[model samples]
Target: MTVLDIDGIDTYYGNSHVLHDVSLTLAEGEVVALLGRNGAGKTTTMRSIMGVTPPRRGEITYRGEDIVGKAPNEINERGINLVPEDRRVFPTLTVHENIVLAHKLAADPRPVEEMYELFPVLDGLRRSNAQNLSGGEQQMLAVARALVQRPSLLLLDEPTEGLAPVIVDDLRTMLQDVVEQDVTVLLSEQNVTFAFDLATRGYVIDTGSIVFEGSIEEIREREDLLEQYLAVSPEEVA
Candidate 1:
């Protein structure tokens, strides 16, 4: 089943036209990557879906219903969640407090304790301020907070940025667990290997348009495609 269908969306910021006729779709339980370099409109695409930046033209349907002009909270209530690249946890709030806050706001949230099951490291730091946690730990917290809302579709932007490889691996394992829960994901990432690991398919976005869409296997095999868009070699991507 199609969880999301974005058809020829043109998004803008003020008078600046950013996305031009960009389109993509997500099936139920599929992890699709929006691959791009810096300033490549990946986050704009995500923002458009979540209603932060409503597209100027074209259609956006979540579960076959039009959502082009809905508010962010309204869209989120419809079971779509977003984890922004900055890992927007409340700095002064405790780890547990963050989850509690999100839980209270969620339309259909999971139990707060379940977050510990998803990220055991968080269990030990439940009492600590979010700002005190390491970058990776904070990233985990951000993801945990989003998942506590029990969203049907998750829009994750750059979850692996600035992380150590080991932490990325740990996050990958935890997210593997998330994928098994039948959650559909639209992952916006510049971390090719990390994105490749979690995504079944990828859409390469450049300057504001989707240039390539294919299975992970097909994307990996195309060295020229990788270099031209992502600026990575075969070994780095794999």
Candidate 2:
């Protein structure tokens, strides 16, 4: 089953075009990575899907219904949630409070205990102020908050953008666990190694357009193509 379909979407900001003819599909229970550098259409594509900035032209079908012009909250209510790159946990709230807030939006949220189990550290620091947590810890809380909503499709934008290498490894493990729980993920990342390791298939975008897309094995076989388009050499990820 195709959970989400973005076909030939052209998104813009003011007069500036951001995403050009972008297209991709996410199958049920599969993890797909959108790979690109800064200023590439990666974030724009995500924003377009969430209807944060509705696409100017094209089709965005979620579970077989057109959602191109739906409101952001409406899109989210339909079981699609985006954990933006900024890790926007409410600073003044406690870890537990942050998770509780998401429940207001979820029609049928998962148990709080499930969230604690998925992120054990959050359980220990349930009462701690979100502002007091470390960068990686904040990221974890952001993800946990989203998962508590029990979204069928999770959109993660640059999830490991500024984390330490060890933390990135831990996040990779956690997200793999998410996939196992039957939540499909569309992760946007510039970290080639992390994306390649977590996603079975990927789309490489450049300057608001898709340049390449295929299985990880196919990408591996074309190191020259990766380097030429993404400036990502095999050695960097290897």
Candidate 3:
């Protein structure tokens, strides 16, 4: 079943045409990566889905319903959640408080214990201010908050952009757990290795257009394609 179908979306930014006829789809229970370098319109594509930047043309159907002009919160309420790259958390709120606050935003919030079990480190830091947590911990918190929304489709933009290698490993594990729970994901990432570990399929976006779409194995075997579009070498990803 297709959870999301973005067909020929043309997104813009105040007269600047950013995305040109970009398209992709996510199936139920699948983790797909939108692979791109900076300025490739990955973030813009995500924003357009969430209705933060409504597309000027084409259709964005979530579970077969047209959501192109819907408000952001309206789209979210329809079971789509976004975890942005910036990892924004309540600066002064305690870890527990942040989790509790998310319940109010969630259409169907999960139990607090479930969040703790998925991220045990958060359980230990329940009393610490979000500002005091490490970068990786903050990223976990951001993801946890989004999960509480009980979304059917999750959109993650550059989730591991700046993290220690060990932390990235932990995140990969956490996301694996998320996938096991049947939450479909459309992940925007620049780290080929990280995406390889988590994605079943891939879409390569360049200069605001999708240039390649195929299975993960296809990307792994095509070093020339990766280098030409993503400027990545096989050794770096391997």
Give me candidate 1's TM-score against the actual structure: 0.98
Q: Quick one: ranking by TM-score, best first?
A: 1, 3, 2
TM-score of each: 0.98, 0.97, 0.97
- Clashing pairs in model 1, backbone N/Cα/C closer than 3 A: none
Look at candidate 3 and tell me the lDDT of residue 2: 90
Model 1, 1-238: lDDT tens per residue?
A: 9999999999999999999999999999899999999999999999999999999999999999999999999999999999999998999999999999999998778999989998999999999999999999999999999999999999999999899999999999999888788589999999898889889999999999999999988999999889999989998866
Q: How do the residues 73-129 of candidate 3 rate in per-residue lDDT, one tens digit apiece?
A: 999999998999998899899998998998787867898879999999899999999
lDDT, candidates in the order shown: 0.94, 0.90, 0.91
Pick by lDDT: 1 or 2, better one? 1
- Could you tell me the lDDT of residue 69 within candidate 2? 87
**Ranking under lDDT, best-scoring first?**
1, 3, 2
Check candidate 2 and list the clashing pairs.
none
| Lowest summed lDDT window (length 10), candidate 3 | 103-112
